[model samples]
Every structure is written in C-alpha cells, then in structure tokens.
Target: MADRETPGDAARSDRRPLDGIVVLDITRVVAGPFCAMLLADLGASVIKVEHPDDPDYARGFPPMVGGGDAGESAFFTQFNRNKRGISVNLKSPDGKELLKQLVRKADVLVENFRPGTMDKLGLGYDELRRCNPRLVYTAISGFGRTGPNSSRPAFDNTGQAVGGLWSMNGYADRPPVRVGTIIGDLAASLYATIGTLAALRTAEKTGEGQVVDVSQQDSILTLTENAVVRYTTRGEVASPLGNDHPFVRPYGQFPCKDGYVFFGGYTDKFWRLTCEMFGEPEVADDPEIDTMDKRFDPDVAERRVKPLLERWFSAYGKAELEAMAGDRVPLSAIKTIPEVVEDPHVAARNMIVEVPVGGETVRMVGSPIKLSMTGEIPLGAAPAPGQHTRSVLAELLGLDDEAIRRLAGSGAI
Candidate 1:
C-alpha cells in the first residue's frame, strides 16, 4: 500500500503554481471575492482588503453558520475561504497611504467598485501603474469602465436582464426568470481571474501591466452561447424552452415515477433506441418521423413524440428507467443540493470539504480545478473582519506595534 497525499502535503510542497504571487483583494460580495479566492486556491497570497469601519457586506448575508448574531454567514465563508483579511479606511489619508504601500508590493490588485470610485480615491489603475508597473490591476464592474451606462449600479439580476440571459430563460409562456444562482457575478469573477492571469503573464515578460476591465453584463452576454449568433446570422430570435434544448429533441428533463430524470439522446440511433425502450419500435421506424429534422419539427414533436415519450417516462421509476438506459444514452436523476453533497462521485472528486472556523467545522464547496502535481489545494476558513490587519501591516509595510496601535486608535485601520 502507498501513503496517501494530503492537502497539508500539497501546501508545504513547492508544487503550487502561484506560490510567490501577492494579490490585493479590494473587492466585495460574490464576484470579487470569488475571483480572489480562486487566486488564493492556486497558492497566491491573497489579502482581502476591507473598509475598517465596515467589512465586506457579504458578512451580513443570511444562512449563518451557528445562527444568532454571532454566527458567521455561510455565504461569506464559502466565497472567501483561503484568503487573509485586512481592514483599512480607504477614505482616510493615512489608510490610503498604507494601502498604496501594500499595492506597491502586490503583483495583482482586484477591485469591483462602480466606475470612477477608484479614481475618486486616487487608487485607479493609471495611478497604481505608476508605482508598480508590473502590477496587474483588474476592475470588475457592472457595465464597464467606458460606456453610456458604465456608472449605473447593477446587481446580479440587473446583469442577467441587461445581458439577454433573462430574455432566454424559463418557459416561453412564463415571465423571464433569473437563474437560481448568481451566474452574473460568478461569470464575471471567472473572466476577471482569467484576465488577471493573462495580464500577469504579460507583465512577467514585458514588465508592463495593463488594466483588465471585466463587466458583469459583458460576462453574462459571453455565456449566452449561440443566442446572439442565432439572432444575427439566422435572423431568428431564441426563446425560452423550459428544460428542452433549442436544437435537439429528447434532450431535456422527463418525469419518472419517483422523480424527474434528464437525458440527452439526440442522434438517430439513440432516438431509435429510446423509442424501442419505450416499447414503440414502430414509432422509431415511422418514415414520417424518422429524420432528426422531422422529429424536432415543432408541430410533429408537440403532437406525436413528446406526449408519447412523456407518458412512457412517467410510467417507470427513476431507477428502473436508469437501468433501461444502460449507457446507450446519457441520463441521470435530477439531484438536489443534499443529494449532490452526499453523492459518491462528488466525494471521490473532493467537491465537498470541511474547514475549521472559530472552533466550529464549516462545510463548503471545494475547488474544482485539480492539478496532478499540486494535488488538492488546502482549504482554510475565511478570516474575521480585519483578522490579519496587524500581521499584514508588520510583514508587508514594516509597521511596528506602536504604529499599528496608533493607526487603530486613529481609525485608519
């Protein structure tokens, strides 16, 4: 038997890709925190910079760990894991200077404020670039730095609506529905991370860093797949189709006796096999509905195939239907969050992990990116407000005990 490697082993080893990088996370809420956390997971020294008087607003979000006023928000803990936190009153001159000092030493600075917010504080990309030419400054905004509506405030729902995501979501008859999750914020975060990495690579070679402007709306639009292409090229506007796919038939969720099962068997062979499994071999052989085009035709499918398939699927239990599938077609029961957390495959992939926080164990979603060399990234608990303020000041800014105390007394930190 071989010894199993642990997250501790991975952390102590030099296999982490971003071992020496320092990231100044001056963002808040989901999008910014998510981006910084991703960098931290990859071994960057991410310092979550918060306002001294008021910490990240996500700390107040609901679903607290232990409940009551003292309990930490699970929402905050999930996104901010594996990052150190420091609070500095950016509005104060002393605090601004302290942040500038930290920024000079940082390789990357990520901020998600409305347009012109950083400029008002004299900490914009153009200003920071002067001090640290190699710093990758990423700004995640609602619209963008330069646009007609760039300055407008936007939340997750606003991004989804403005980006055409809502227009194409939900059933065609129902009102446009926002996605269950904050895809707008998450998508922007992923894009910001990518932009930061690319900028970092360029800075390493050329010693010149540029601003990476990521907009939530723009990010959401990018993820709309072929919605824009269909409109522009084919002159056909895409509409909501519930769980059904736009281009393929028998590629959506179907009801079973126990629960709903989703399957996608788009090809002719799989379709034939599906019909045979439903005890309708003659339907598969029917020349009128043989071809993909004919089968997917709205009138034909709505009147003949869909109802028949739905009835057949409704007759069988989920387990029975899964057995009948037998890998000939793609199929699975729609899993809830609880089911997902307990699933064997999720456990095998280390998608759920527990971290110790404030003397309590908190369960959180694990990092998805797996590196053979680095192994699993170490998961740590999110810091309390200004948790690392003193330590960070001492190490990064060379501030001693007296100076740190003075700054705290003056409300600068």
Candidate 2:
C-alpha cells in the first residue's frame, strides 16, 4: 500500500502512451467502466463523473474491502482503478454547465446510458462536438443508438440471449445456459475500446471527432464467427455438442483418473500421435478410421473411437496423460481459478497485480497489453466519490475557492 502510486501522481507522469489525454468517464457499472479503465491503464487521465447524491451503484456491490455493509466494493475498485472521481448533479443547471466546461478541455468522453438519455440532458455527441470538435465521444448500449430496440434496457444476460450465444452454449439435452462470465458486457466494452481508439486516431489526424456507437448484441454477434457462416451456407443449425468438435474426432475433453484433460487431435498427424499415445496404434492404422472424414463420422467416433480413448484415459491421471501425450498432442489440464492465479506462467507474465485499497492491498487481474516503449503501466487505486472535485475544478476549470464553494453549496459539484 505504501509503495503504490496514487492516481493523481501517476497521471502527472510523462512516460505513458496516453499521457496527455483527458477522458471524461460518465459511465457506470461494467461495460463502460471497463473501457475507460483500459484507457486509464494506457496513461489517460480518466475522470469518473458521478451523480452528486447517488454515485455508481457498483460502489456498494459485494466483496467489499471490509466485511461490513459500509465497506467499499472490491469489484467496483478493480474496474475503476487508475481514475479520479468527481460528482455533479447533471439535472441541475450549474452541473450541466460544469460538464460542458469539462468537455471543452477533454480529449474523450464515454457513456453507457440508454439512447436519448444524454440527449435529453443536452450532453449528447452532437452537442458536445461543438464544445470540442476533436473530442472522441463513445456510446455503449444494449442495441445501439439507431435501432428499433435502442431504448430497450439490457444487461449481460440479455445480450447473451439476444445475440444467439445462449442457444449454442451448454449440452444438447440441457436448457440454454448463459456463459459463466459476463462476456456480453465485457465483450461490448472491448469492442468499444477499439472503436474509441480508432476514432481518436482519426480525430487527431483530421481535427474532427465522431461518435462511436457500440452495442452489446453486435459485439456478441461478431464472436459467432464460423457458426453464422456454416448456418447460412449449409442450412445447418448448430447445437450444443458438449465438449465435442463438430468437424473433428477426438477433439474434446477426456475424463482422466483425477480430472478432465482437453485434447485437440484435429490434424491427421496429431490424430495418429494421440492414438499412439493412448496405446491404440491399431485404430490409427485401420483403413476405415485412417482419414479425418472417416474418423469424424458420428457413428464411427461415438461407438468405436470415443469408447476406446475414454477407457484409456480413465486409467491414467491428468498429469500422466499430459506427460505421455507431451507437446505432440494439444493436451491441457482444465485448471481451476485458484490454480490459474498461482500458475508460474501467469506470474511470469505479470497477469496478477496488487493494488492499494482502504489502507490494505488487494490483488486483481493485470492488463494483458504490453508495449515496448511505454513499459509497464502503473495500477492505481480507485478514488472515492468526488475525491478530486475541488482540485479538478481549480485545475481544469480555473474556478476559485469561492466559486467551488458556491457550486458545492448549490449541490452541483
């Protein structure tokens, strides 16, 4: 805790890639916060704008710093790291003017409110572009800003169900299941981040800013990739095949003595190697099962090859199976979360980092992007609500103490 740099201190440093850029983050919860946090990690000065009376609801979410009702949420802290915070009641006239002032100096602005919410408040992209023509304005929502369902409220599950992900997940016999993680919201955030960066580049070059409209459904649909192509071209509907691959035999998870191990023997060479490793060389040599197409046949794979490999795998432990197959076969043991956190590779790559929170240290997932020139990005603590209201107003808006006091008295800070 003592060694970690504060967000303000980090923002003052010059070595970051987005060092001089200022981001006005008027978003709450996962999708929007995740996107802004990435920019912050890359060295942007991100200012999280919250309501004067009610801040981001995630601030009170579970897994708090202390084991009480009043503690700060670690979940919120993890996503909002490396950002300053300010509170402003946008419904108030003073607050609106304050935001407009901030917009004049900001390089980027991000929000995830449903379509028309910002427009009603006079803070939409069309309006803000007038303040700063070079501002990169991004909006993330469930269905995007120009669709029939643009105003429909959605969360992670809604995106998964509407985008066809739930239909293709889980076992064929079971009900459709949402993925374990909030991939819907997270994926939209990732796509929005990419769109924002690209828009920023264009804005910098042409001195013109544009709106980046990102939809959770659209982002999830893009991940369907080959499934959509296969359905449209072959008139085939994909169903959950458990861990099995649709086009290859012996390309799924196998139950070992202790746990499950994934083996992808998709290529002919790997198929033969897997057979040899499983002590079933005869299966590899048989003319009926030699080629990929023959081995991929449902009846052949299910009744003949699968049973033999299952029996062989059931006799060995996961580690023994991995060692036997070695690098020749694409074998992996399905590790749990704790195992992954303690893994040697993860440590070496710095994928787990410790940050200060509430006078203590908490570990969170680190950024994956590595830059040669910028080096390691600093991870800073998330700020308290309106923590920098006075300082930011003075520094950016050139407001004196009297002005700041007046704004605060009027409930507009």
Candidate 3:
C-alpha cells in the first residue's frame, strides 16, 4: 500500500452530493456505465470491475488521436471519467469471493448484462442481495428483465426503432428517420441513474435495498411526447411531420439565408407574433390561419406563411433574426457542431471543458450537473489497463502483496 495520509487529506476530501457512498460498477458499454459515472461525479467511490480477458468493448472504438492500442478510445474515456478500474474474472471462485467481500462494503451495484449472464456468473441480484442487504442493485436490460424480446440483442438504434421515436421523426413525405445522437442509450442511462438515486433514498429510509430494473425500450418509450396522447384521445396514428410539430404547424425547421432556423409558434399568440415579426399581419386576420387548430395544418400554414417568412428572414442574418425574435416566438437557426463548440453562450456556461492528457489538451463536454456548494474538481486522465488493480485490491479487499501477485499469476484477477 502507498504511504498513509494525515488528517489534512481527510479534511480536504471532495464533498459532493454522494459523498461517503461507495458504488461497485460491474457494467460496460453505455447505459450502466453512464449511471456509475454520474454517481462517481457526485462523490461516490466508484470501483469499475472489468474482466481480465478484456476490458469494456467501448475502449476499442475509433476517434482516437494517437492511434494507440484498444485502451485509448475517446468514447470510453468520455463516459467513464472520475472512477477507478480493477480487473476481476467473475468466473473464478476467488474473484466471486472478492466481489462478495466488496459488496458487503458497497452501497450500490450497477450492471448491464443480458438477463441470465450475471446469474450464470453467480453474481445475480438474488445471490448478491444476500451478501449485502442494503446494496442497491440496478439492472439495465434490453426490452426488460422478462418478456418475449427480453433475451434479444439490443442497440441504441434498436431501442429507438422499437420505442416509436423513429416513426415520428423526419418530414411527413419522407421515410421514418432515426435521430443522429444515441438518445435511446443515453436516456436509459439517465433514467437508470435517477432510479438508482431514488432507490438509495428509499433504502436509507427503510433500511433495506431494492432492485432498479431499467429497460432501454421503456426509456425510449418515455420520449414519445404527444404521440401517445394523439393516439389515445383522437385515434391519430402520427406519421412523420419532419421538423414541424405534429400538434402544431409553423413550428418546423425553415430555410434561412445561410442555414436554417426552427420556428416554434405552438400557441395562437405565438403564431400571431410570428406573423407580425415577418410582416405578414394578414395571416393573423385570415379565418383559415388565425386559430390554433387551423394554424396547425402544415399545408395551410406553409402556403400562407412560407413566402413571407422567407422574405423577412432573408433580409436579416441569423443574428438579427434571433435578436428580433427574442424568445417571444421561439426562432433560431440550427447550428452545426463546430458552431456549437464556438458558441459564446456555450463557452460562458462552461459546457465545453479543456483538459490536459498525454501532455496535450483535449476538449470535451463538461459535466452538466453543477452543484452550488461543491465546485467542480479537476479529474485526471484515464488510466492504462490494470493500472489501479494492485492499489484497489490492497485498499478495499485488504489483500497483501503476495495475494495480489498470486491472483495475478493464477489469472484470477
């Protein structure tokens, strides 16, 4: 073990929302790992358990700068920050015993394996819950824990397609489209985190732990805003309306001088204001276009307003239009990725953070959750494979040097 620290180290410890909490993260890929990262960011002592045969598959993805080995993928680094890594082959008896020992001291356990994978490894919730009665077990799955599609494979696109999000995207005339971002995976992960925190709160109150079952399909299902309402109340099986709102017209993406601006006039007042801003006050008087119901017709609204909107928006640039719109009618041009990176407001808000790694600086998005009392701490770069294995085994499991060496030699860790 490293030399012991004094009282000053304890006094200067980072204090955040989840301080004093310990999380054992036995998840990989996106959803489960993201939840663990969020907990770690809030001051949880998160120990990421990986297999000795291979680390998380995400560590081998592309978009790497140095073109090094599989351990340097940016996708893995971005989501797995602020946590410690250790190697453990759960198939081994020693490894299972080690994990049980860690679980006795853990507050939460997160996993994202197939339904029966964990049980095969003997670390299923039923077995592990017995090891620690207060351990919060979070299981993130594909369709769900039990169902017809529960055993099927799933990815972000699969979830999006199954959840009705893709059917509602794109223009009404074109084919259904999937969102560019991995929203399905991200949403599931975020909901998993929320569920974990809720379970943690309940555990504290009741002095018992519970299982949090997160389904990617279920998470994606939650994103179908008005689609469900329209289907249930009006028998409206929604199709692609493109950038326009399904329930409101004149609320879609429109062409600007340089790029495109999204105009969202969801209400009658906003619709009127949109017409006024574009010097098309006659639209506000037309019985066919005045009311919210009439204005919601894409054909009617587009025909009556597109030309006037184009002429008005063409006269001024994006900045001028944005300034004139002034959040009254909700108008702003769609920006590219580079533009988003250089946006002044984004910089001002510290959304893009610069960090030093490999003796150079790399830019990435900062953590969105900002606490007033506990300021953001500087996190170091991702470690190499098995970088902290010896230290973690020594500190948490109280394994001596001989034991660690024996485990490493026998391929048990």
Candidate 3 C-alpha lDDT tens digits along 73-189: 666767777788889889898888888988988999999887888889888888998999998998888787888898888888988999998888877778998988888888989
Residues forming the 10-long window of minimal summed lDDT in candidate 1: 6-15
Query: For candidate 2, what is the TM-score?
Result: 0.93
Candidate 2 residues lying further than 4 Å off, grouped into runs, are 1-14, 279-282
Per-candidate TM-score against the hidden true structure: 0.93, 0.93, 0.91
Query: What C-alpha lDDT, on a 0 to 100 scale, does residue 146 get in candidate 3?
Result: 87
Error in Å for residue 60 of model 2: 1.5
Displacement of residue 213 (Cα, Å) in model 3 is: 0.4
Give the Å shift of residue 363 in candidate 3: 1.0
Per-residue error for 319 in candidate 1, Å, reads 3.3
Question: What is the Å distance of residue 218 in model 3 from its true position?
Answer: 0.4
